[model samples]
Target: MMKILLIVFNWVGKGTYWRALKFAEHLCRRGREVTLLATSQHNRIGIEERIINQVRLVETPDLFTGSLRSGWDMWNVCNRIAWLRNHDFDIVHVFEARPVALFPALYMQRIKHISLVMDWADWFGKGGSVEERPNPIIRNILRPVETFFEEHFRTWADGTTVICTTLQQKATELGVPPNTIVMLPNGCDTERFEVIPHQIARRRLHFPHDMLIIGYMGSIFQHDAELMACAFDIICQQIADVRLLVIGYCPIDIRQLVKKPQYVIQTGFIEDEYLNNHLASCDVCWLPFKNTNANKGRWPLKLNDYMAVGRPTIATAVGDVVSLFETEPIGLLAEDNPMSFAEKSMQLLHDSTLRLEMGTHARHVAETRFSWADLTRRLEDLYQYILKTGTK
Candidate 1:
């Protein structure tokens, strides 16, 4: 049996968390032994260990509690290294290039002679996510640091898995071989994610049945939120009965951004138990991403979330989203401007038959094309090849 170690920088709740956890679960069923290492709390010094659905999850302590990003805690890195010393695995796949994940994975490869593979989910370097920082000081400080960490170590890994074509291109430009790189986008929860009845979902939440609802999954960046606010403002003028449904912890202040705060329903931070109901309540979902490097280099996880709930999306035609929209009639794509986005939203709102047809197609696409089974199989193939030739 092949024993694999999967390392992610943070614990549960984020997109990266789900990615690593799902891969671990799927790979386990494929007859591979998988252990996931992550950072749970900042205050604790010792490790907290548990088994989640046959996969072992070992949580290390992160020293810095105040910082929003994980993997900066040196104490966490040392703990991970110490923990890894006792266990032996055929392959170690580190999810991100942060200090906590990258340094320890590198140690196991260099010192222990274990095969190492790195997964690049986001572009976090010189021309990538560093530019997404709103503060100029933060951007300037992270520019070289992010570049050094994201670029300097990727080439040395045995193999690389990227989430999008944008990052695949970036990895190749950074000197990684084409053969060693695998591009796997986000997948849907076809088996586990339940689709609740739309009317019942709205009634359970006490949302009015008469109003036309437009949902935007939360956790947006400042600039993306700016584009969303602009599009939403234009939407409100033409359609007076429209409501904006926000389903999670949004950094953007919807109340202050719009003309009608009453129409905005923010659900704050919600647990996974109520996720399906909240998603099913919306008539249409929106992905108001601007045409920027940050938006272009990354694939939005919420797009799949919307698809899972059988909701048609009004997404901006940016990044790899262009291909997904052009290939499938799952949803309509809007231009970068607010006027175009509002127009697309109105187009869907006026026609319920079109929305239903597009939404059903979206769900079909999710179940067949972007399922986790196919993704894990491809990843398993990569693991087999890496173990055979070491991607040299």
Candidate 2:
């Protein structure tokens, strides 16, 4: 049996961690021995090690978590390299391309001849929109490292998995063979995110029974809250009983920006059990991404979750969202502005039949195309191919 090691740079809370776990679980079920190693920010916390759903998960303290002073990063990289030597892995699947992520895999390649697979989920250079760029000092320091990772990592990697076509294009431009790259888009855990009756869900969450709820769930990054506020205001003027459900943390206070603060409900980052209930309780879901280079490459996990719960989404045509909503009528797409977004959302809110139809289509798409079960099979096939054909 092939032994695979999945390496993540962060804790179990993030998107990468979930993706790694799903892959490991599926791979283990297929008779491959899979182990996932993740790092946490907490200091002096006991090592988090467990066998969850047949996948082995081991967590350790993040080497450079507290301080970024001189030599700490290198020390962490060396420690990680040393730790990696203890395991006998046929493949090292890295989720990021940072120095810490790369050095250990490079060491394993040289010493143990284990193959390496790198997954690129974002553009990772210059960071977000032009306005969102880091300060000059930070920019100057990060520019070279980001550039090196973007340009040369694929050339050295044995195999690559990309989240979107933009990253695939970037990989091809960097001279990575198309055959070596697998298009592993983000997916939903359909079993967990399945539909619950809206009335029951709303009752459990203490939301109004008659109101039309518009939900925006998950972490809010590069999402224009001001624009969403304006859109919701327009939605309110058109519809009599409209409510906005904002779940998770946002940089901007969406409640303060919107006109009807009373109509908005903020359920600050709840547990996963409550997430599906919140998603199913909504009449419509919103994905308001600012149309920027950084957003263009992202595949929002919330979009998949929304679809999995059988709710129609009104999303800005950014990133993989354009391809997702454009090809199929599962959801409505609009420009990344207040007026355009508001118009599409109002159309969905007013038309109950249309919303139901779109919701059905969205669920079908989620089950057929974006289920983790299907996606993991693809991942397993890719791993098999990589193992069969020696490292490139």
The sequence of per-residue lDDT tens digits that candidate 1 reaches over residues 154-195 is 899999999989999989998999999999888888766656
lDDT of 1 at 359: 87
For residues 106-178, write the lDDT of model 2, one tens digit per residue.
7877788888898887676655332344377776777666767656767888899998888888888889989
Can you list the residue pairs that collide in candidate 2? Answer: none
True lDDT of residue 318, candidate 2:
82
Error of 1 at 50 (Å): 0.7
lDDT of 1: 0.87
Span of ten consecutive residues with least summed lDDT in model 1: 62-71
Give per-candidate clash totals: 0, 0
Q: Best by lDDT, which number?
A: 1
Clashing pairs in 1: none
Best-fitting candidate, scored by TM-score: 1
